[model samples]
Target: MPAVTVSDITTLARIPEPAPSAAERGVRSVTEAPTGFEGEGFPVRRAFAGVSHTDLDPFIHLDQMGEVEYAPGEPKGTAWHPHRGFETVTYIIDGTFEHADSHGGGGTITDGDTQWMTAGGGILHIERPPEALVASGGLFHGLQLWVNLPRALKLAPPRYQDLRAAESALLSTPDGGVLLRVIAGEVAGHAGPGATHTPMAMVHATISPGAQLRLPWRRDFNALVYVLSGAGSVGAERRPVRTGQLAVFGPGDVVTVAGAEHQDARHPALDVVVLGGAPIREPIAWGGPFVMNTRAEVLAAFEDFQAGRFGQIPAERVPHGDLGELPTQPA
Candidate 1:
């Protein structure tokens, strides 16, 4: 097969998005990520907890799409779907995820591990129940971020970045707060990870209950927070976020978070994700599982995937081991 171009996926994508002014870029004050997003056909259960590229950038959506706790044998996965032009990153904090795609690239993602897959040009894939997680019996928690590749890199090549827990840095604060720094330019005066293909801010933060933290953000980037475990407040404005909720900030160079009464020492584990990125102020054309700039380029990606262009298997030396088979749907 060649590749599936945008024409193959139809014009159902490229839906209009909100365009705030440049003045609205840096978020100093914080606010909730909202409850009801009208578009996107999936059941809008708060399961889709992601930050949309509403203003400062074109990073698209960042969903901390944690799974609902199901019984031992319930269906636990996403059906097969298609994507093109963009990329999907799966970061696991707990539980296991087995994934496969049209490219013959598939594997089991364990806790504290990450898989970066760029669906450049075109590709079809799915994510669902993992024999490992299903057997382990616990809540499934992770983040799936969509990073838009610049037009030049959109169709260049599909790639992967598999990071093990020890391979990355996990920073600690004096008050027992931990941050698993994954990607983007840099942090704490450290240089960029060189792991990510694009500049991004992806950190997993967990503070003991009642701890306070103040973090820096460049005046040029877009930033936000998603509360995972304990409940708390952030910023001088003091916005509250429970588990599974996102708090987006407006125009600020740094972020200040204060622990709340409920986040007392007794609770201890308060989980949160500190995520942000500088905006890619370029044209954006997105729909379904893919994202690209121009409609023509989108069509081209669809055609490539449909033609088997984007489905090439990774070489044996790439470290993914044997991925078994090409999956038309998620397993």
Candidate 2:
């Protein structure tokens, strides 16, 4: 993938997103992913449940992190951890997240920034709120998704990509009541900034009252939508979903998402993320932080971590950088 630079951002972002094609439409399924907490005390609502959902193959898990507002001087975050055989994609919406890994890769991703980390082979990393944020309380919200790697690439080298909000490709409805931001894959011929080993699309969209949007999709991909806030309807069946709900779509080449005609002013727009990927149909053995094709591979991952091959950061050295202190939102 080509690196995104300042000179080209405006032009790329201005490109119009593909409109939804008029074709046979069907509402495959609408189900809410269970919500719970993981990692220290942070709350997370899982969009995909269990080891795997056939409809959401290749994309193993999606965790909607706390949209919680922390009390002054009482912030909390994740501790050092190890992962292998897949990739971790973190997208922040409201707060700051400081990251550090064994490969000496570290950075801060605040509002609208995304951090995509491939934990191939193995890696020890930590993600937490910065000390400055903890000292002064604020809102913390984001989403962390786990994308399964094909068996052939599960043991590939680890890599990281941090994309700021401005680097993404953005498009809006003619009247600007709806906005679509593509972070990965292409929309309406406009390519996003993040490159993926697996073919996928990660789009964040916001629709205002009575607005409608139709985006073209790939027939081969298993698509799903998660309403981050407010309420909306989607597909030909016009399945309704509100905040914290996950809608898994059936096979289709075009997705239709529309906002409520009478939207609540407090939560005026329907905010959601559309995710889809080509399925990796191979058998998978999921064991906590590691995901592999075979039980033996899963054992090997744990052994390697125990043997210290994943590398480690001192527990005392928290927040690794002052990245959170930088502007929370991109210019």
Candidate 3:
């Protein structure tokens, strides 16, 4: 395999048709993400889920949360909740978030940090804005992805990986116009620190004026790109995509994205996240916060949580550090 570099990504720049046997292809479909509320009335847009858009295999759910601004003391987040049989990847883009779980895991992740949590057997956790941030009132934006565990690892031990932004792999064009921050997997020989039971890649990219990128991906993995901000063109055909839209790809190992010039100067750059992974191709029994291979396992997860098997969080230990005046809800 050839090394993926800044120059390698621009092979199809300004081109119309991909060459015969080209590793990249055009877009298959462009769809809008569904908007909803979860985690104690926190607003989010669903990129995909097993209940709908079932083609994405190991990745069960993707949620793009509030890029929306909030008044002082109005931000909302989830209280303690139990999860089992899968993992949750939380990527913070613009704000601070505090985390606490039953496994004695806790941390404060600010801008550009990713928290990968695996709720293998069962784990109770809380995720929300810091109290201080709520008091100040500002923009809070990020992504939360639910990656399914294979049946073999469904009952594995719970764990957490905190990947800070400074530690992520940064990819840029030769002239420094385009920037890609890889949080997991590899690009141009630079790999993220996230350890995974299931192989996958997650990249956050920012495209400046007229910048372009061609990303090499695993041929066997299913891939999709979500437009987080501004407008841009994706794939070889340069299909136009806007914020809140998801571009699903066809069979190919590479995808191209270009930054388009926009009339609004306030939002000149394009922001996107690329994600891909191999299909688990196993039975999925999903309930509120649990994902298992069978309904019986899901039931057992609930019973374990109820029986105090997942552990407990002390009231004094709960994160009130930056909680501000916003009312907190129990999960």
TM-score of each: 0.73, 0.88, 0.87
Better of 1 and 3 by TM-score: 3
- Looking at model 3, which ten-residue stretch has the lowest summed lDDT? 322-331
Note the Cα lDDT for every prediction shown.
Answer: 0.57, 0.79, 0.78
> Candidate 2 residues 144-183, lDDT tens each?
9999999999988999998898888877655566677889
lDDT of 1 by residue, 44-158 (tens): 2242234345653646666554444545764355645567667787777666676677676667776666777887756655566566556655556566777777777777566
Candidate 2 TM-score, true structure as reference: 0.88
Give the C-alpha miss distance for residue 203 in model 1, angstroms: 0.6
- Pick by TM-score: which candidate is best? 2
The sequence of per-residue lDDT tens digits that candidate 3 reaches over residues 168-276 is 7766655566777788987656787788889988888888757777777778877788988888899989999988888888878677888887625656688889888
> In model 2, which regions exceed 4 Å deviation?
1-25, 50-52, 314-331
Flag the better candidate by TM-score, 1 or 2: 2
On a 0 to 1 TM-score scale, where does candidate 1 land against the true structure?
0.73
Backbone N/Cα/C clashes per model: 40, 2, 5
Candidate 3 error regions (>4 Å):
1-21, 49-54, 318-331
